[model samples]
Target: MSKPKVIVIGAGIMGLATAWQLAKKGANVTVLEQSAVPNPVGSSVDDHRLIRYPYGDKPGFVAMVRQAFGAWDEMWADLGERHYHESGTLVFGGPNTPRAKVQADVLATQGIDVEWLSPAQLVRDYPLLMLDDLDGGFRLPTGGTLRCGRIVAALYRHLTFQGMDIRPFTQVKDVDPVTASVTLADGSKLTADKIVIAAGAWLTKLLPDMASRVTPSRQIVIYVRPPAGTADAWRKMPCLLDIDGGNNGFYLVPPTPGTGLKIGDHIFSRQGDPSAERIVAKAEAQAILDKCAGRFRNHGDYRIIEGKACFYTVEPDEKLLIEARDKALILSPCSGHGFKFGSIVGTRAADVVMGAADAEQVRRWATGEAP
Candidate 1:
């Protein structure tokens, strides 16, 4: 596999990151993107994506996150710019605390400290919160936001500088796994030593066999401007997550230096066409504001700056779905939590393609079962 020629589909974070890693490993990689490198409809093209230590019942991801951070650090070094902001995380253990407690225990094993916030403290400190909960929560210094859009752009530039071929607006119609070739919408074909289908939400279109295994999800996130009364709190607010058992609660990313205040729920719509126009309905915007307004002060007057819709590939069990398909590999580090692991997903997969890593090991690791 020395200097293998590879063809990568999709130019989102995962796709571009894979190309970057592949180029680093001396592979001649050609990346075909349906849209621009920083595709606006991409799940990774957001103002910010969150990374927190508390993974609820999925403790394996807690350790995997450590590797993700390391990978990000390496990318930052290569780009000479750090696109992450450590705002910490404020957790609210709603009526359900079992999953929250498991998260706490997992963090404890890693020597991460959690400062418990009593009910009285919640009332005194975060005046922005409604604090209807009967009990208390904690604040861990291990969560933050990654500048997603910036990272994508930087990776694209980095790959280009490395002499990698990245073609945007090149739609891939189908793939020939046996010969490791990709058929374009224009009837042009390109062959390579290996093929990568990291097409995020549109993965099923390229690999119909994965339709039952991965469902495209339509998720919305709204950027808002807080009233002057709570502007300070909103500006200083750490990335917050409320542990509400199975029913997904809201996760808020506070404003960073050049970012907006973002709020999105963890629930998956499980219904969307990635090729369809992204229209964020008024009801959709209201739904998010309504669910999160109760958690903040000066909510009624807060103005919705913008509402954007992104699509994600979700699996039934909520773990990453990275599998091998003859000469092609399908990478889905998503289920609403993919962007955070973009760098590592590319690194591990590229290593496998370069014959530097074990394929089954990467799959197992992505499933959160790697030791």
Candidate 2:
């Protein structure tokens, strides 16, 4: 029997990772990317993204994250570069908040090394956070940031070297699952034995019927240059998430070699179209700056050094939808927070496409499937 030919749409971390895994399994894989690989418009272009275990309240997401970290380690060893930072993560917030307590509770239940810190303790360890009237905080020693863009570029290069056909600037207009073929924007067609739709925000554009279930939202990231002379302090800080005081967002990185601190909010829930999404708005940028100024330690006169607006195809429940539809498999995790699981999700997506596993299996582990 001949190896199955797989066509994966999208070139972001998830799509590229899925293509790489399929190719490694001896499948004839072709990745179709609408824009250039590692396009800045996608959510994967940030300087750093959080890679942590223990997702608040979701044991399944926590397990997936643990597995993902392992995959990241292997990639780092293979690529001969340190793509992940082990600065750890701090989740601080009010005692009664659902996300805050869930994060602390899940870590404790899983035997994950996490220190629950009181306001005074938090101030002693990480003076950057304003802990006035705060309930509590937890620290994950293994949490940190990943160089997102570099990782995507590395995966693309590695897959290309493995003889996988990656077509850039190739927009997929339509897919005929029944016929096992895809129509390109240039009026060309490509046939495949299996197809996986890993398109980030544009997944609904191709499958309009799914628009209601998968709505893309506009998300923004801001680069804040630390106050002069205090750059070292900010650089040494670990990736942090301020879940206290009813705030739900997290900051995953500090200043790198030359890059300044990157910050953003995770409160984007409004529906948006990827094609029509705004790049950045003055009002939105100002709000983020104000929040950072109020919360960050030694708050500097921050300027919006650079702003990037991307799409997050969020599900109603914020859980991923990895299911089979007719002859096509849909592998998308729309939670505004799915980029961190790119490599591991990609491997599981390949398993689904090759019939080695099913969607239920992926969901089982992601939702809390035990070993």
Candidate 3:
């Protein structure tokens, strides 16, 4: 029996992951990437992307996170190398803050052990952090960092070894969902038994009809080196969500072994051309630091390693939009919070592609609604 043929556009994490799952299912898979596979500017290709369980009001993610861990573990087994580092995770808040505590209680109800901390406790535990006017925090062992660059690179190698055709620098100019075909920029068209559009920020560019629904979000992330006095403290730092309830509330990934300290906010920029220059403006980088000022000790001495611009698709509701249009499935598992679910989201996408799962159910599940 001939294997079902599948073509996936966009070699970002979501695209690559869906391809990975389809290939493993005995499907003939070809991945077309406008840039190189694991595109550096791709949202998933970075020193580290976080995997945490504290979804303040989004309880559906909490359950998905549990499954995400298992999916990633299965990938690790297949790759023969673990590209994850589970240092820990912390969610902290300001004076009279109840959201951080609410996050803790939510996790506790899921039977996950959560360590609640008081303002005084935070100061004693994480001394390098500025603790003034802080009230609540929590520590959890399940969430940490996923070494994204390494994982994607490994996936590329594994997929290549499996004889999957991955074409880089092959831009898709038009996608005809009804025919399950893609017209390339060079005026060539390729038809497939099934097509998956896991395109990231470029989703709107290919499927212009989705322009009003999902948008490309330009986000900024910075890597910094802490001063000598606080280097030790940073070495022990956990992935943190600085929950001050403002636009500056960024999630931070610690400078664990072989990684640099990364800080970025969850707030979406809501605008930016993915095809345009991704140069990070000095003011944009500085603005992030300004929002974080006084939150870190020796803030002025922290050296900026790199300030980069990245992009992702975001819906107003910030849920994963995985839907189908005839033989083509549009999987935009985006927003600012999509990286953590990369592994399992791919598995679910495969289920839909192979006709094993209902597309509407997967759509509802991805949106955090009842599946």
Candidate 4:
């Protein structure tokens, strides 16, 4: 029997990871990316992304995150490159806040080497944070940050080294489920035994009927320089999420090797077209800076060093939609928090395409199969 030919759409973390897995399994694979390889606008272009084991109330996601770390480490070792930072992570919030307690409880239940820090303890241990208003928080020693852009580039490079065909600047205009073929924007058609749609925010655009299933929302991320002398302090700081701060859902990542500290709010509730989304405007960027100024210590000058607008292809339940749509397996992992699980999602997406796993199994291992 001939080996199956798999074509994966989108070249972001999810698509590249899936293609890498499929190619390694002796399948003929081709990755179609609409823009240039590692496009700057996609969710994967960020310098750093948080990688934590305990995901609040999502046990399955917690498991998937754990597995993803292993995969990332293996890849880094193979490439002889540092791709992840073991800077730890702090999830702090109010006493009765559900997210904080859930994270604490989850860490305790999993025996994940998490420390429950009281308000005073947090202030003493991590003086950079605003602990006066916070009730308590949990610290996971194993959590860290992942070099997102580098990972995506490395995956693409590795797959290219393995002789997989990667077509950049090739937009997948349409897909014919019956024929298992994809038509590119230039009117060229390519056939594959299986297809995987890991298109991120563009997934719904490709399948309009499923638009309601996935909505693309614009989000802002900002990078700012810490107070001059405090650069070193911020460098040593762990990734932090203020899960209960003003219901704004703020998170901060340490300086990305060369870039300044990164901060963003996860409070977007509006949808927009991914292709036409606006980069962070001055007013919005200033607001984010102001928010960070109050929450973090020594966050000075507040210059909008850099700002970006990315799309989050959110599901109603905020869970991933990993299922088979005809001959193609749709692998949209835009649950607003998908970047953290990129490696694991990529591997599972490949498994789904190869018939090695089903959506239920993947969901069971990733998010507990939704009750």
Candidate 5:
């Protein structure tokens, strides 16, 4: 029997990973991208993205994370290198910390190692933080960061080397889900046996019906240099999730190899034009700096290095949306914490395409409901 032909729209992490998996499974795969494979405009680009096992209240998500890690391990084996940094993550509670505390407690019930630290211990052990006003936090040893840009690039190279067609700079004008065909910007149509739309924030434009369920959210991540004396401490600092600032509280990714210290909040604007030029206004950027000033110790010593704007199609509950419609599967594997699970989501998509799993099962698996 001949291998099936597959068409994947958008070359983000999800698309690339899916393509890589299908190719490995002996499917003829072709990936389309509006930008380069490592397009900075897409949600997957950055110096680093945080990946961990502690998902505050969602044990289902935590369960799925285990599978995600395994998927990444498989990718590492195939790529002949690893793009992950195993830095432990520390999460502090804010006014909303009670909810996070509940999440941490649930994680403990699942046999995940969690170490609660007192104020004194926090100060003594992690002096780079200003934990004075916070209630308390815990350490989850399984979490860390991924070199996302490198991973995407590696997948592209791997897929291309495997004889999968990767079409960069090729914009997809329209897609016929029922027919499993794509109409390109140049008015050309390409048909395939299976179609997967992993188009991140651009999902709405391609499928107007998904506009309400999956919204394009404009998010920001800023990289900074630690205060003068705390450089070493910052470098060694594990990823931090400050739950104290309520919605404004941000997650911090420490500087690891090939990356810098990054700060971003889980808050989603749920508004933005992905095609518009990314312009970070002075006041908008300053607000983030000011927010960080209130959260971090020695804020004055930190120097603003870069501010980047990225987009993601977010579901209301922030779950991964992997729905098979007609002949296509629409994938939104990111809300804020999606990068860590990219490898698994991609593999799952391949499974769905190859009839190894159904769409509903993939959704349940993504939410940690299925084994």
Candidate 6:
């Protein structure tokens, strides 16, 4: 009997990871990308992304993170190199802020270790932060950072070496979810036993019905170089989420492994054309720069390295959409926080396609219904 033939759209982290998983289960896999592999326009093409156990108020996500970390460990073993940095995470807020405590409570339910710190302890432990007004926070050592772009590149090379067909610069014009086929821009057709659409921001273009639920949010993040005397402190810093601080709260990714410190807000703009130019406007860029001024110490001494504009398909509640539509699987596991779970999602999708798992269970897990 011939193996099942599978075709995956998009070469982002999710797409490549799905194709890799399918191929591992003896399926003939082919990945099609409209641009080169690791396209900068895709949401997964960033230098680094944060991975941690803190889920704020969403407790279901805490369980999902445990599974995600396990999946990444498997990927790291297969790739023959670890792309993860275990820098821990520090979430700070005032006593009125309940997110830090909520994360600790949820994580404790799973027997994970957590340390609660008072305002004085927080300042003493991480002196680089300006937390004079903050009350307290929690620390979880399980959190870390992922070198995202490097992982994608490694996946591409590994998949090709394993004999999976990867076709880049091939634009897909139309898709038939019922037939498990797609039409190329040049009027060519390709059909497969199963089709997986993991197209990131471009996912809505193929599935118009999801346009309302999954919106493309144009978000911006700036990279910066810490001041002369603070290099040592910044290098030893953990992933910081200032949920109870100024500018409505922002996430800070410290300069790990010689990478630049990155700063971005958690709020989604919920607007932007994924196909439009991604150039950061002067005013928009300045807003982010100004936000950093109040949050970081020696802000004026830090150099603004670069400003980036990227789009993510954000659902209203920010739960991932991983339902099967006809013969196609719509896998837009995105909402700014999806890249961390790329490997696990791929394994689940492949299991469903191969009849090893139930589609409903997968949907429930993706939506945080049945963790």
Task: Tell me how far the alpha carbon of residue 96 in candidate 6 is from the true structure, in angstroms, after superposition.
Answer: 5.8
Better lDDT candidate (3, 5): 3
Name the candidate, 1 or 6, with the larger lDDT value: 1
What are the TM-scores, per candidate, against the unseen true structure?
0.96, 0.92, 0.96, 0.93, 0.96, 0.96
Can you write out model 2's per-residue Cα lDDT over 110-164, one digit (the tens) per residue? 7776777777887787665566656767776677777888888888888788677
Q: What is the C-alpha RMSD of each candidate to the true structure, in Å?
A: 1.7, 2.3, 1.6, 2.1, 1.8, 1.5
Candidate with more favorable, higher lDDT: 2 or 3? 3
Off by over 4 Å in 6: 94-96, 245-247
Model 4: per-residue Cα lDDT at residue 368? 47
Clashing pairs in 6: none
Instruction: Please say which candidate is ahead in lDDT: 4 or 5.
Output: 5
What's the TM for model 6?
A: 0.96
lDDT of 5 by residue, 144-234 (tens): 8889999999988887887788999998989998899999999999999999998889998988988888789988777777767776777
Question: How much does candidate 3 score in TM-score?
Answer: 0.96
Segments of candidate 5 deviating more than 4 angstroms:
94-97, 245-247
**Per-residue lDDT over 136-171 for candidate 3, one digit per residue giving the tens place of the 0 to 100 score:** 577887778889999989999998888889999999
Residue range 6-41, candidate 6, lDDT tens digits: 889999998998888898888998899998888878
Tell me the lDDT of candidate 5: 0.83
* Per-residue C-alpha lDDT of model 4 across residues 1-371, encoded as one tens digit per residue: 89899888999988888787787677898899999889888878878888877676866667667777777766677566768878877777644768777766776665676677788887888776667877777776777777888888887787788778998999999987767899999998999898888888888778887786778888888887666667777788888776544655678888856656888876765567789946568887877777766676655654678877878787777777777777888877766777777776777777777788776777555554432
Decide which is better by lDDT, 2 or 6: 6
Tell me which residue pairs clash in candidate 5: 56-103, 94-243, 94-244
CA lDDT, candidate 4, residue 253: 84
Q: After best superposition, candidate 2 residue 215: deviation in angstroms? A: 0.7
